[model samples]
Target: MRQPPSRTAVLKVTAYGLWGGAVCSAVVSLLVSLRFQSLAPGLDQKLFLVGGGMALLYAIGGCLAYPGLVFKPKEGQPG
Candidate 1:
């Protein structure tokens, strides 16, 4: 198994990314709700689903890339 990155680095990076993703998703959802509410009169439910889905995707990407954030220095392995 590949070794993990330093815990503190992972936490800090992930936290910042998550916070940004969350704020972006919230703003998008709010805009969607307001823009489409006129057509459906109550589209918040769908807007939330879309926003949540996007946030989930961002989180998954962050998690997948976390391992590579700090590559392990292989002993005796040539670059």
Candidate 2:
């Protein structure tokens, strides 16, 4: 039989996922900003959409990740 995941493992995975998301968001936002530099002159519309979508993804990821940090099983229970 397979063992349950540990709190430490869960936290580590969550942290990594968040870190990766932040990096990806930064890179993507930067690229989008650069791409629009000549045409839009500023973060007019598309950037907002990209930013908002990234924010939404982060929010959802955080919501899913936080449960692993907040809740843990007892010694006798499966994690």
Candidate 3:
């Protein structure tokens, strides 16, 4: 059986996961935005900023919320 990871280890893993997710999200967003730019004549700067800000907030919330799910304790182990 695998030993439970330390809190610090769990946090480190969470941080790395969050960073990887954010990078992936940003890259996808960039590609979509570029595609939009090609399809549309002009993009609204404020609209783009608001959308990006909302997405960043969502990502931060998910990073804060998901560690509990990822680091679940094994059966018979204290959480």
Candidate 4:
């Protein structure tokens, strides 16, 4: 039988996935905001802001889920 994945491994994958989503959202927002010059005066701004908020939320969730990715373990501590 195959062994189940460890908690840390699962968390690491989740964190990476969230971060990747954040990047994709930000990029798409930027492109949309820049490419659609005919959009209403403030609609583009709203879209950009909403996208930024989503990116921030994703990044925050990723950080919370896998803090080890952002902070190094102290010396002698098992990472």
Q: State each candidate's clash count.
A: 0, 0, 0, 0
Candidates in order have lDDT scores of 0.67, 0.64, 0.59, 0.76
lDDT of 1 by residue, 1-79 (tens): 9776666566557756875786688778778877787677457778877887887777665655454445443344332
Clashes of 3: 0
Q: What TM-score goes with each of the models?
A: 0.49, 0.52, 0.49, 0.77
Stretches of candidate 1 exceeding 4 Å from the true structure: 1-5, 45-79
Give the higher-TM-score candidate: 1 or 3.
Answer: 3
Top candidate (lDDT): 4
Tell me the tens digit of each residue's lDDT in model 2 across 8-61.
567557756875786677567767777786775566356856865785677567
TM-score of 3: 0.49
**lDDT score, candidate 4, position 13:** 79
Q: RMSD per prediction, one decimal?
A: 8.1, 4.2, 6.2, 4.3
Q: Pick the winner on TM-score between candidates 2 and 3.
A: 2
Look at candidate 2 and give me any clashing residue pairs.
Answer: none
Give candidate 1's whole-model lDDT.
Answer: 0.67
Please write out the lDDT profile of model 3 over residues 1-79, one tens digit for every residue.
9978866556557666766666666666666666677555555343455456656765675566454555544454332
Output the lDDT of residue 57, model 4.
87
